[model samples]
Target: MTTNLPLPQFYSQILSTLQPIFDDTLPLSDPSTQSTLTSALDNLYLIQRMINSLGVFSENESIDEVGEKEIVFMSLNWVIGAAEEKGGLGGRDDRLSALQRAETAYTSYLEILNSYGVLSPEEQAESSAAASGQSSTPKDPAKKREAKIRQYKREKELRENIANSLPNQPESSSSPITFLLCLLPSTSNRPSVISASTGSTSVNQEDPDEVSKSTAILILRLLHTITIASLSSISMEMELLSNAPASIVPLSDRDPREVRREEEDNTWKLDRQPSKYKPRELISGNGRVLRPFTILPSTSDMSDRERLKSGVFKQSWRLPTMTIDEYLEEEQRRGNIITGGGQASYDAPTESELLELAAENDGSALAEEKAEQKRLKDENWARFADENKKGAGNTMNKG
Candidate 1:
């Protein structure tokens, strides 16, 4: 018959064997060392069993304890063997397997301890009393069942309350890259914004650093929109360029002519002025005048160079022809007036010629008048000739 050792002594022996094995410096890779460790753990389990059989160990000792111990030790042995096969402890695969096995063993042991009656002295007394008929008291069976139901309901409520207490989280703020795209100038000509590398249509891939810098500049423009401290923070983070010194006049402050002159400094350029040909003004019968018109530039003084460089001259001014009424207004402003000679011509006919012409008038009126005059002249000549002819015939008979 084996003499059983105290629980503390057995626990200490197990720890002593495990401590050296667990040490970082220990050569756990060596099969001999691993074998020794395994044997020690086996002896410890045997001692535990002996203590349990003698009733010196806690009654709470789990029935599966020996099997669990063997499984853990064998798992570790396999892990060590695998590590050696795979070129030693440096191989992550072997070490990972070992750690997994150790975690499983520890978890199993903790579960066993939790499930078993690992009670304090007071708890042990209460449990013993409950088991004995001396402390057993009868309660209403219906009341006991009601209490159990209440407890179940309370547990369910508690679980639901815990779930309800959790918050609904919101999506994160839009990226600075996305915000910057909204600030870009609107143009019909720009292609659909996309990143070539990602093949994504999202414009957010525009350089975040650049976006941040631009946003800082834009915010600075709207001084009233943000506090000075906020602006300072943005400036520090983005490293924005300082406002240009007061010595430089902003383009807005410059004269239109100066603006144009600066814009067209480049070599390739065109003339900035309208053509020399002016449209003629015509006066109508209704005292209205129509004039050919042209639109003058907003700043006629701006030179060709400034207009070109600034792209201010890219769009030509449109000229609309002035209506007769508008043209007259301009003429009136210049103090011009209509003369009597401006009226169109009309003439009258003599009375005698009018009467004869009317009498001879036919559907072909002019031709009928000429034909009547010719017929009258022929009648007069024929009568004169007949008188002459009678006298001449008498003279010839006397001869």
Candidate 2:
């Protein structure tokens, strides 16, 4: 006695719940955003379970032959999108885990597409070339480094993979509700259904074609973008963990035994008992030593108490090596300055002076009249000077 899956109802709920993601006006900070998204994820997870319960998917099953191919493809897309928004959904424990789940789901979908022979000849050849390192990426060192990093992330995700975790075949005796609860791993612990109503979404049943294959490639690229950033973050976190001291909890909260062990760890111990003590430069400021010691400041650092920061640049005036005159002299030597007369100091007469001398020598009526006026002027000057003698006027400073 088999129980039918209530996919129609779940589909309706999934469509209504997912409407928020497509809404442009919806604010992420809205109180209902997370609640609505959580509900949507639950319905989407239920859909996955429903599809899995039909036993229609397998390593040998081609996407063209599958009835729920479109639904599965879109579901993978939506799941990945949700993972980007909330970090994880339903049974997923964290953001990274959620991304891994999405990656796994998309990869499985791609496998089915490949089996269906949906890729074009050119695309297939390009993919093959990339696999063989012919030219999927550029020859630039930066691009190569990026490719290596992504490859590392991809390989790591694959190695520590967690698949969709579905049943291999359909169970006739099991009800889908029970199968759902069983398959979900933690349905009770996951988000509860907020609301469900009558809704509809168009389901495509077209055979795999070039357009569909192009869409698959797009989805792959989307997954790549979302996963790389998250994987890089995860890698950084792991690096931090490796570098961090071995204590996650506060000293007070740590176990006495652990604290004792940590305290003991600080004490030095030799792997081999040395027969004699040898003087060695174990620590130095120079690069010769692997472990360098901090050079303590003299008494002045404590006296000043500036608490000066390292690595921060502060502009300052350096002590003058020479006076302003010296600097100006150097600049003058470099042809940056000029003094005295640049050209007026020459002994040669200028053209304007020569023209003035010629005008004085030229005998014209104007010159004769100017000479008579000059003689009158000289006589008038002599008479005025004789009249106004040095002590004649009652000046304040008279002798």
Candidate 3:
């Protein structure tokens, strides 16, 4: 008999409970917020169980990345909503405290994944054979050297494999919960400043579009920074693991029986020496080895939905909020700075200077008009002279 999966229902319930809370503004003290949070948390528990159970049927499946993403999204609502005084869990200080705990848990989970090592099937088989003592035992110095070299090669390969398996940004097949998580920060506190401006003290309180636009941009930036930091951290951890000493066996506790034998009858022996194997450079999937704390290129792209709304919100994204009179005064000041003299070296025009400038302009206009009239007079005189010359030529022909 085919068994039904509970994940779909779990997701549905989470959506149902969280959707209402997300859609409306309710007070933190309201009973509905608590009830909704409880429901969402319960559904999240189910989702976690389902994620854990993924490995049961698919041996090769690694749901670690997906599980981390799932839980992060599940926790974001609480993290964001719990701190809001209105329509949030803010009234209770304990819930706000819980947000910090949730953040710590998220960080710890990512760290665990970074540190965990998984051996491949081939490596596992080799290790099993060596542990069982079924492989050829080193009977000479050359054989011992060969064994050490082989082990080193295997370890290098393993490190390369692990490094290649870095986590990626969310894909299209990712749950809608990811987008919802992205929108969570809209409910969080607005920054004192959004776009940088020298004179602007705060964001425009009048424009809701501007507020939403700034909030969205902030969320995208936060996501980008977080993801880059996480990847860089994981890369550093891998590098450290690769460079760390393989073991710490003391010289006094040396086991003679386990040492390489040069002869079957123990007539000859070789000194035990460490392998001198140098590892190759570790590169990521993109062929770049990231240094510790190196900022990766931003993977977060604002969605199409955000782009559509940008026209409305970002219309004045950089513009400062001020009264009409203040705006006019600022503009006039800027004009004076630019036109009065370079770098505001000249003071504002006095009444006499303004009159002089007006007179100069009037005189220039009059001079141009007179020049045009003179040109027309010259043309008329020339036409009259030509007419007279033609009359004189006609009279001469008659004579």
lDDT of 1 at 317: 40
The count of residue-pair clashes in candidate 3 stands at 1
State the lDDT of candidate 2 residue by residue for 79-116, as single tens digits. Answer: 53443444343322344455555445444443444455
User: Number of clashes in every candidate structure?
Assistant: 7, 0, 1
**Regions of model 2 farther than 4 Å from truth:** 1-9, 15-40, 58-74, 77-96, 121-139, 142-253, 256-399
Give the Cα lDDT of each candidate. 0.38, 0.43, 0.39
Worst 10 residues of 1 by lDDT: 166-175
TM-score of each: 0.19, 0.34, 0.24
lDDT of 1 by residue, 209-273 (tens): 22232232322122111111222232332232233222346688889998787667433233334
Best by TM-score: 2
- Rank order by lDDT, top first? 2, 3, 1
lDDT of 3 at 104: 41
Off by over 4 Å in 1: 1-7, 55-108, 116-399
Better of 2 and 3 by TM-score: 2
